[model samples]
Target: MTQTPPTVAEAIRDAALRLAETSDTARLDAEVLMAHARGVTRSELLLRHMRDPAPKGFAALVARRAASEPVAYITGTQEFFGLPFAVGPGVLIPRGDSETLVEAALAAAPQARRVLDCGTGSGALLLAVLANRPQAQGLGIDRSPAALAMAAANARALGLDARAAMRLADWHAPGWSAGLGRFDLVLANPPYVEDAAELAPSVRAYEPAGALFSGPEGLDDYRVLVPQIAGLLEPGGTALVEIGHRQAGAVCAIGAAAGLSCVVHRDLGGRDRVVAFSVTNELAA
Candidate 1:
């Protein structure tokens, strides 16, 4: 006699147990993956848990998760600032920590009509800001064409394509900012992980390295980008860039050297996550 397949509830429970060995949020990960495999929402999965059986590929997804793959990468999507963004191997998955940069941007330049995102990974920062400020137009620059393609695809998915543009530009290259024009706001979440820093296995193994590691000190990109802020910003323009929790003082110093006033913003966890800068004090005045 053939054996009966496991119910959705059973599958999720087993998956969660297996994932617990590697994931901190095993149950949450199981629920999310199960919901995705069933082509339903988490709520729907909960309602149908005992009634339906696991989908065909549910076990495969669980195995992938058990191996420490990020649930967002496994699901190919991540939610940020109340928006869903497409994510995959080449792009950095959007994290809640980065939302601090988005919030800082909107609060610092509420009237900004033009914005720029320098290392636009998934276009999360630029797109989130544009979504909130419907009157704003924004541009995202990245050295990786794959990342740019992902960002552009996200712009189209969110219906912000007309107002958001992605381009190929490397921050370290001379004149990388040329022809981009001045913007009322600038945002960047440049690579800031120190080369030798220890990272979670999931992050170090799956996320794109070029998007994570800056240099031996992890401030190399900030050194190049912060100084260029003055040249990219309008007279009273503002910039909000994400930094490692310990990078506040060093990054602020770099901004100060460029004649930009810098202020650090902490994330919900009370870690310094964003450094807001302005070319002039007029905005404060």
Candidate 2:
């Protein structure tokens, strides 16, 4: 006899079990992937659709997750600062930790009329800031055409295109920041993962390596950025840089050497996640 197909709830339970070996948040992964497959929000699925028949191709999604693909990549979207951004293969998925950078920027320069975001994957940082500071005009630069395209598209989708623009430029390239002029605020969440640091299979295999790994100590990009920050900022402008929790001391040192003082900010988890910089004083973090 043919077995009955699983209901949405049953399918999620089984998918969670199948994914448990590969994912720490397997149940959450299953629910999110299923909600996407069903074209509903996870909350909607939980509140109203659990007993409904599973959507077609849910098993396929589960299989992808079972192989360790990121849920955001499969859904082609991720939320940052309450804004939905399109993300996939070449784009770095926006993380919550980076929100700390946004909050710090907003608090530091609420009237920032000009903003710049380096390595602005998907335009989440620049655009999210513009979304809040409506008077701000923002520019996001990236070396990858794919990332620039995604950032541009996200800007348009969010109706921030008028104020947010994407450019193809590498911060590490000589004279990369030229013609960009100065901004009232600058943001960067550059690659900070040490070359030898261990990462999950999903990240190593799928995420863009250019956006994840820095040199030996993961200070490569910071070395480039912190020095130029003073020039990028309008005299009193502020620069907010995201850092790996452990890199605060080292990153603050880099800022100090550049004659820029730093103020460290902690994420909800109380880990150092962002540092505010200005050329006025010694490192304070």
Candidate 3:
């Protein structure tokens, strides 16, 4: 006799148990994957938990999650600044920590007419700001064409394409900002992970290495980009760049050396997450 298939509730429970061995948020991951597999939302899955059986191919998605792939990568979607962004293997998935950079920018330059985003993977930073500040136009620059294409696609999807322009340029390359013109606000979430620092399997094994790891101390990208920011900003303009938790002092020094005053902003976790710099002595409150 054939056996009955497991219910959606049973499938999620089993997947969550398997994922719990490797992930801190296993149950949530299971629910998200299960919902995606069923072409429904997590709430819908909950309502159908005991009524519906697991969909075909649901187990494969669970296995991928069990292997440590990011949920955003598997689902091809990540929410940043309350907006949805497409994410894939070639791009750095947007994280909540980076939202600090967005908040700081908006608060500091609410009327910013021109903005620039370096390392614009998925265009999360630039697009989020543009979404909030409707009068703003922005340029997003990245080295990877694949990442730039993704960012451009996101701009179109969000109806911000007319105001957003994406280009292929490496921030580390000298004069990469040429002809970009000065902006009222500049933002970046560059690669700041130390080369030797231990990363979770989901980050190390799946995310793009170039987007995560910098040099030995992880300050290499800052060393290259901080100095150029002052030239990129308009008078009284602000540049907010995301830094590693331990990078506040080092990044602040870099900005100071460039003759720009710097202030650090902490994320919700009270960790140093963003360094705001300006040519003027005062930054926005």
Q: Which stretches of candidate 2 lie over 4 Å from their true place?
A: 281-285
Candidate 1 lDDT tens digits, 74-154? 999999999999999989999999999999898888899999999898999999999999999999999999999999999
lDDT string for model 3 (1-285, tens) is: 998999888998999999999999999999999888888888978876646888888899989988999999999999899999999998999999999999999999989999999999999999999999999999999999999999999999999999999999997777787899999999999999999999899999999999999899999999999988878989889999999999999999998888889899999999999999998554222
Looking at model 1, residue 165 earns an lDDT score of 94
Clash count for candidate 3 is: 0
Name the 10 consecutive residues with the lowest summed lDDT in model 1.
Answer: 276-285
Residue 223 displacement (Å), model 3? 0.6
Instruction: Candidate 2: give the clashing pairs.
Output: none
Question: For each predicted model, how many residue pairs clash, with residues at least 3 apart or on different chains?
Answer: 0, 0, 0
Which ranges of candidate 1 are over 4 A from the true structure?
281-285
Ten-residue region with minimum lDDT total, candidate 2: 276-285
- What lDDT is reached at residue 264 by model 3? 96
Q: Return the clash pairs for model 1, or none.
A: none
User: Where does candidate 3 have its weakest 10-residue lDDT segment?
Assistant: 276-285
